[model samples]
Structures are given as structure tokens and as C-alpha cells.
Target chain A: MKEVRVFAPATVANVAVGFDILGFAINRPGDEIVARLNPDITGLKIVAITGTGDKILPTEVLENTAGVAAYTLLKHLGKEDLGIELEVHKKMPFGSGLGSSAASAAGAVVAVNELLGAPLSRESLLYFSVLGEEVADGSFHADNVAPSLVGGITLIRSNESLDIHHLPVPQNLQVAVVHPDIEILTRDARAVLSDTISLKKAIRQTGSLASFITALYTNDLPLLGRSLEDHIVEPQRKQLIKGFDDVKKAALECGALGCSISGAGPSVFALCDSGYLAQAAGQGMQEAFALHGVNSQLYVSPINQDGVVIL
Target chain B: MKEVRVFAPATVANVAVGFDILGFAINRPGDEIVARLNPDITGLKIVAITGTGDKILPTEVLENTAGVAAYTLLKHLGKEDLGIELEVHKKMPFGSGLGSSAASAAGAVVAVNELLGAPLSRESLLYFSVLGEEVADGSFHADNVAPSLVGGITLIRSNESLDIHHLPVPQNLQVAVVHPDIEILTRDARAVLSDTISLKKAIRQTGSLASFITALYTNDLPLLGRSLEDHIVEPQRKQLIKGFDDVKKAALECGALGCSISGAGPSVFALCDSGYLAQAAGQGMQEAFALHGVNSQLYVSPINQDGVVIL
Candidate 1:
């Protein structure tokens, strides 16, 4: 194939109870990457960028997420000598905490792999994608990258070892996400957190996470809602996002099973049992954010089964 | 149903990553309780105590676990005026960290319910059992009581609300328990713990627990072994049990899937894929304890499905 284009879905990290450890993919508001053979150029290059509009994303091969991901994969395949050019199309808002950078990195690797006739397995490509995404936050966490690259609900048992596991998604599970017209840097979101937490809180978090996993396996929606509580991270980070409490309350009252900040937000997410309820929750969240004088974009989607896919 | 005898299986609480939140029942070395309707008495009474040599247990209705459980059930049923006598049989060692007190309470409640024509559902009985067991350690934790009452693996989401959930057990899963000839009180073990813990450790613990639950649902034995790690409670409590480190190492070396302190200390438990491996691990653990100049008792069995049963 001379050229390939892929869409990498955005992801919701933390998932209310699984801070830095769990995430799930959504179908829309992702990034698109186009990889083509450039016989004139010897290594990878970022030829064009679109859809980001004055955001001034990095374009250098070593600095750009898409560039780095494609470059890393090419290097691993001993194909660095191959001529290739990548065009990044950022469909999602930057710093919205919906895994915008992860979509870029994931899409790049997937497009490049398809252009090369798929030399590597999907699992093998995750390492390069995670490394590329790490440049955005300077952390090796894969809660966002894993789900954006592999889809469905993902669990990272050990970020150091990149031990990723895919959890079963209930058939009726849907998500409602509202990205406010504001940016909250991942570094700033992380800074609000404390180094130490009460042991009691830690146990409670573990119980919630454990129960959440069980709920997924058993298809117990009520249990999932009850378990989707964050005792450690969310409390500290929610203050950074405007109208978080009101938005969450609105979503829950609108029939969301659970609601919390998505990733390092300005973006808040709600999980619902049906598409209709997800849409209702999304509108509720948007209205709640607007009440705080914050404009927001809403997206309602079922759990994405495919992560990055060829267009 | 004038007189009823019931046996309550012993339980292993904590389960490595789920301190005060998760546990499972085992087949043998449980307390047996016999509840008889008495015409002469007008309230719950403890008439006989056996199987505990040189270890004096409380016989008073409020102080004794069995008596408390029976009295609580009777009171809840508006049958406080009914005549009843309970026989307390302690088959398991006290302060062994094997849910000895929980077994007594669970057996007492089950026997009393049976003698009263089983008016209360098993779910409703958990409250009385937990209250009865709470007197032993003065904490409202139900990790032990829930499993002993409901059987299989149980997760207590909230001790305050008495929220309990039963988890699925793999068919081939086996347990090996080694009680070193020593006793470590739960209160003392809890005393040595820090009220606060590092956030990094807490996240790691949640990841392990989530992975463990996934492993159970998927029937992934190797993943279960990898996730059966305790970061916060095990390290501090292991010091209270002599030869703990060596015993755990021995169990792992003997084909055990995972090994850790059973509940608090002194007694240790190992999980294995088959009965043979569990038996081997039990012997290895017993031998390791013996090398530390501590004689130990060993029990190996499959995951018990039936908790308290009629005798």
C-alpha cells in the first residue's frame, strides 16, 4: 500500500475508580493520521498538519507525537531508511483530557503499520505508541494509550512493564463526555494530588476498583455505578475543572450510572446503560457547564470496540 | 426442627490485595454450633462450650460470639422472649488469623435461623454474624463474616452499609493453609499499621486487585498469581508471623499460584490450580515453619461453595 489513513479514538482514563490504571475508548472525537511513501525523503517527516487551528502542535519528527510514534515503529522494524511522510489531523481538542495526544500517537503507528503491510502485531505497536504519548506528559502511564490503541475497556496492571489487559464491556454500556472550552494541563492536574493518602482511603479505592471489575464481568450496572467512586484523585483534581460537581450531579440525575472527571479534565464523562440515557446525560452535563458560564462540546458514544482503524 | 446443628467453614480474609474487604470460605477446621429450643429458658443462653482446651472463651450472651449472634437474630425477629440454648464448639484455634470468631458467629446465626424455621434470608443473617464477630476485634469489618456466611469469594464494598458481594470461584482453584503454632491478635496486627500510605503504593494495590478480579472472571490462573500481591498490609503484618517470608517462598517454590498471610498473621494461605499443588504447597509451608522452630497444622481443600451447613 502506497498510503494509509487511520482513525484513533479518544479515551477516558481513570474511569472514576481506576486512577492511572484504567481507561476505555469512544468512537468519535479522535485523531486521524495519513501515512504515505515519500520517495523523495529518506526518513519519516511530518509534511502537513490540519484541524488543530493555531494550537501550534509540534511537527518535528522527534518532537511530534504522530511523528515520534511512526518513527519509533519504523526504527523497530529496521525500516528507518524507508521514505515516509505523515499528516496529522487532530479532531479532538488539545488538553481536554480525552486522550487527544494518545489518539495522535496511536493513529500514527496504526497508519504506518498499514502502509508497511502490517509487519507488527497490534500488541507489539503499543510500546511505540506509549513512548510517543509519554512526551506529552513526561510520564510512562498507558491508561489512555492502551484503550486508544487497543479499544474497549483496558486495565494497566503494571505501567512499568506495560502489562495491559482488556476487560469485557457490557453490551448496553454507553458514554457521555463533555469537554468544556478550557484547558487543564496534565502536569497541573497531577500536581494537585498528594504524595500520601490515608490507608483507609486506599483500601476503599481498592475495593471500588475490584468491585468495578467484578461488575463488568457480571454485567451488573448498579454495582458498576456504586463502584465508580474515586476517593483519592478525583477529590483533589475536580476543583481544577469548572462546575464539575454540578455537571456530575446533572449527569447522574439524567440517568447516568456514574459520572466523574475524564482523564485530567476539563472534560467530564458519564457512563450510562443506554444510548438514549447517554445522550440525555451529555445534554445535562453541557447545560450544567453552561450554567457555570462555561461552553462545552458534548459527545455520546457506545464503548468503541475498535481502537485505531483504517478509514 | 426443635434442635439444629450447623457447621460454619473457616475463612481467609484480606486475600492478599483486599484488606478488610475480600475473603473466601474453606471446607474444614470450622466451628460447629448447636441451637436448641428450650422450654425452661426465656432468653438466649450459652449452655456448653467445647473443643477449646485451656483457652477460656466468654460464655455470656453479650460477650460470646455464638451467644451474641443468636441473641441478635432473636431480637431482630421479635422473638427475644423465645427460649433458646446454644452450644459453642471451637474447632479452629483462637487468634490464628483464620476467622475463628467469624466461624462461631456464622455457625450460631445459621443454626439459630434453622431452629426458628429459617425465617430470615441468608443475606439478612450477615448483619448479625458481623456484629457477633465485631466483639472479637472491636472493628466492624466483614471480610471474614461475609464469606463464612455466604460461601465462595466475597467482597465487602462498604462495612458501614454492610454492602456485600459474592465473587465467582474457578472450578480448579485450591487453597493451602498453614497455621504456625503461634497466635497474633487482629488488633495488634492492625495496631502496627500506619494510618497513611503512599499514593503510588495505593494505585499499585488497586491495579493488582482489579487484575485479580479479572483473572477470576476469565479463569486465568497465571494472572491471578501475578495479581495476588499485597503492598500495604502484608509487609507490616508479615513481621508478626515467624518464618512468614520463608513459608511464602516455600509455597511459591512448591507450585503454589500465590501465598500470603491469611488474614492478619501467624496463619498463612496459598492458592494453587489443583488439589495436588495445594497439598504440596501446604506441606512446603508446614516444613518451612518447622525449620523456624515452629510446628504448624496444614489443611488443603478446594474453594468451598457451601459455607455454613446442616450437620
Candidate 2:
């Protein structure tokens, strides 16, 4: 095929409980990437940047997540000589803490794979996706990238092997996402966090994360709710987001099982048991943000089992 | 119901990846407690202490684990005026990191429950069991008591509400426990650990723990093996056990999935997939301890699915 298009779903990184190690993909707002094989072009080129957050995205091939992802894949395959044109249509908002960069990176790799007649496996593509992410953010963490590429909830075992495990998504689970009209750079949010955590708090986080995974497999809502607590990271990072406490309280009051900042945040997410509660929680979160003079976007989605789709 | 006898199984607390939250019951070498309701006594009394290592256990009613557990349960049930005589038949070695005190505590409370018309529920029993542990160890932790009372693998949610959850035990899993002739008090082992850990290390611990729980439900042996790692506690506490590194190496080389200090120290347990491997691993662990001029006792048993039983 001369051309291919792919859509990489947005992912909720950290998921409140397991920071830097856990994330889950979600449908709705995601990034669409179009890759075209062009023999006339000498190297990978960023053809266009469109959609909701186009103004913020870089059209330069070296700087764009999509372009960087395409280049990384071709280089790894020893086909860097191949010419490719890439377009990133960002359906999700930029710096929204919804894994927008990951979606763009994952989408570009998937599209490039399809354009090149499919040589790399989905697991292999994760390496290039992470490399793409490194160009956008200065680290090689795959909590978001793995889920955006592989779908469902993921645990990044180690960055060395890029080992990723897909955890079971409980049935009837709903996700309430609210993005406030504010930008908190991932670097800035991360900078606010302390380098060290008390041993007692660390042990609690380990227990909570383990419990959260077990709850997913057993479909125990109460345990899941109990396990969604983060004593280490959220307490530090929550300060970066405006009205974070109010948004979280509103969501919890609206029947969210748990609430916390999604990824590194200006955005927040709540886990609800039912779709009705999810919608209500989302509205509650938005209203809470509005009370602080912060307008917000809301998305109530089922746990997205399938990640990137070729459309 | 005037006289009741119960056996609470030994538990492997910490379980490598989860420091203060995870534990599993084992079949053999537990505490056997006999509780008798004698109106003539008018207060709790510790009548006897016997078996492997009884010299260290307290004989006084207020100081003895079994006596304290009985007293706590009776006081909670508003039946403190009822006279109770408790006998602690310590089948498990004391100060061995095999939950010896927890077994005595859990067994005594269970026997007292039977003798007192069985009014207390299992969940309610955890509160008193923790209180029982406090008498022996000076802190409230239910990782051992919960599994010993409730059976199988258990997670203690909160000490306040005494909320506990039982996790599914893999059918093919075996536990290889080796107790070297060394005493490492829980308080001392815990004291060696630092108050804080780096955020980088904390995140790794969380991922490992989550992987461990997921492995149990999925029966993923390799994942379980990989997840049996402790960056926070084991590294600091392992020094308390003689030849700890050699013992762990022997167990791992003998095909055990993972190996670490059972609870606090002195005793080390290795997880195995087969009974044959469990036996081999147990022998290897014993030999490793023997090389350091330490006598050791070995127990190879399947993960005990049933905790305490009435006799």
C-alpha cells in the first residue's frame, strides 16, 4: 500500500494509584496519523498538523512526535533511506494529561508499519513508539505508550526489555475525564514532586497498586475503590492543577469510585462503576472547575479494550 | 463448647514484593491453642507453652500472645468477666519469621470463639487479632493474622476497620520454607530499614507488586518469579539472616520461582511451581544455611488454602 492511516486512542497514565508504571487506553478523543510512502522525498517529512490542538504542534519533522516516531521506526528497520510523509491530526487536546503525545507517537508508528507492508510486530513497535515519546518528553517511560499501542490497561515491567502486560479491564467500568482550560507541563508537574517518599508511604503505594490489579481481575469494585489511593505521588502533584481538590471531591460525591489527576495534569479522571455515574461525575468535575473560573472539557468513556485502530 | 481446640497455620508475610500488606498461610508447623472456659479462673491464664522454641514466649497471661488474643477477644465481646485458660502448643519456631506469634494469636482467638458460642465473625476477629499482635510485637500489622485466620493469601486493607481481602491462590504453587537457627526480632529487622526511599525505587516496587498479584490470578509463573523482588525492605533486612544471599541463590538455582525473607528474617521462603521443585529448593536452602554452620528446619508445603481449623 502507498498510504495508510491509523488512530491511536488517548490513555490515562498513572490511573491515580500506580504512578510511572500503569496506564489504560480510552476511545473518543485520540490522534490520527496518516503516513504515505513517497520515493521522491529524501527523508521523513511532517506534511501537516490539523485538528483541535494543531496550533501548538510542531510541523518540523525532527520536532514533531509523529515525524520522530516514523523516523525512529525506519531507522530501526534499516530502512531510513525510505521517504515518508506524515500528518498528525490531534483530536485530543495538547498538554491535556491524556497521553496526547503518546497517541501521536503510537499512531505514527502504526501508520508507518502499515505503509511499509507490516514488518514489525505490535510489541516491537513499542520500542519505536517510546523512542518517539523521548523526542517529545526527555524520558523513556512507556506507561502511556504501551497502553496506547497495545490497548486495555498495561503494566510496564521494565524499560530495558520494554515488557508490557495487559491487565484485565473490569466489565461495566466507566471513566470520567475532565480537562480544565489550563496547561501544566509534564516537566513542571513532575518537578513539583519530591525525589523521595517515606518508606511507610512507599509500602502503602505498593500494596495499593497490587490490590488495584487484583481487584480488576476479580471484579471487586469496593476493593478497586479502596486501592485507588496514592499516598506518594498524587499528594505532591495535585498542587499543580487548579481546583484539583474541588474537582476530586465533586467527582467522588457524584459517585466516582476514585478520583485523581490523570497523567501529569491540568486534567483529572474519576473511575465510576456505572455509565450514569460516570456522566454525572464528569459534569460535577467540570462544574467544580468552573467554580474556580476554569472552563473544562468532559469525556465519559467505557474502558477502551481496543487501542489503536486502522481506519 | 466449654473446651475448644484450634490450629492456626503459619504465614509467610511480606511475600517478597509486598512489604507490609501481603501474606499466605502454609499447612504444616503452626500454633495449636486450646481454650477452656472455666468460671473458677475469673481472668485469662496461660496454662502451657510447648514445642520447637517455647523458651522465648511469655508465660504470663497479659504478656503471652495466646493469652492476649483471648483477652482481647473476650473484652471486645463484652465477656471479659468469663474466665478462660489458654494453652499455647507452639508447633512453629518462635522468632523465626514464620508468623509464630500470629499463629498463636489467631489460634487462641479461634478457640475462644468456639468456646464462647461462636459470636464473633471472621472479619471482626481481625481487630482483636491485630491487638493480639501488638502485645507480641508492639505494632499493629495484620499481614500474618489475616491469612492465618481467613485462609489462603490475604491483604489487610486497613487496621482501623480491620478490612481484609482474600486473594486467589494458584493451584500449582508450592511454598518452600527454610528456618535457619537464628533469631531476628521483627522490631530489629524493621528498625534496620531507613525511613525513606527514593521516588525511583518506590515506583519500581509498586510495579513489581502489581505484577506479582496479576501473576497469581493468571498463574503466570515467569511474571511471578520476576515480581518477587524487594528494593525497599529485603535489602536492608537481609543482613540480619545468616548467609541470606547464599540461601536465596541456592533456592533460585534449584528452580524455585522466587525467594526472600519470609516475614522479617531468620526464615526464608521460596515459591515453586511443583512439589518436586519445592522439595529440592527446600533442601538447597537448608544446605546453604548449613554451610554457614547453622542448623535449619525445612518445610515444603502447598500454599495453604485453608487457614485455621478446629480440632
Q: Give the DockQ (2 decimals) of all models.
A: 0.85, 0.73
Stretches of candidate 2 off by over 4 Å are A52-60, B52-56
Candidate 1 docks at the CAPRI level of high
User: Per-residue lDDT tens digits of candidate 2, residues A162-215?
Assistant: 768889888889999999989888889889999999977876776678778888
Q: Please provide, for model 2 over B82-185, each residue's C-alpha lDDT reduced to its tens digit, 9 standing for 90 to 100.
A: 88888889887788888988988888888989887889877778777778888888888899998998889887656555667788888789999999999887
* CAPRI level of candidate 2: medium
* TM-score, one value per model: 0.98, 0.96
RMSD of 2: 1.8
* DockQ metric, candidate 1: 0.85
- How would you encode candidate 1's per-residue C-alpha lDDT over A1-311 as one tens digit per residue? 38998999999999989999999999989998999998888999898999987789888899988888889899999999899989999888999999999999999999999899899999889999998998887888899999999999999999998889999998799999999998788889989999999988887887888889988998999999999999888899999988889999999999999999999998999999999999999999999999999999999999998999999
Error of 1 at B187 (Å): 1.1
Per-residue C-alpha lDDT of model 1 across residues B54-162, encoded as one tens digit per residue: 9899889999887887899999999988889899888999988889999999999999999988999999999999899988878888999998998999999889888
Give the range of the ten consecutive residues with the poorest summed lDDT in model 2 chain B. Answer: B155-164
> Poorest 10 consecutive residues of model 1 chain B by lDDT?
B182-191
Instruction: Please report how far candidate 2 places residue A153 from its true position, in Å.
Output: 1.2
Candidate 1 backbone clash number: 0
Most lDDT-accurate candidate: 1
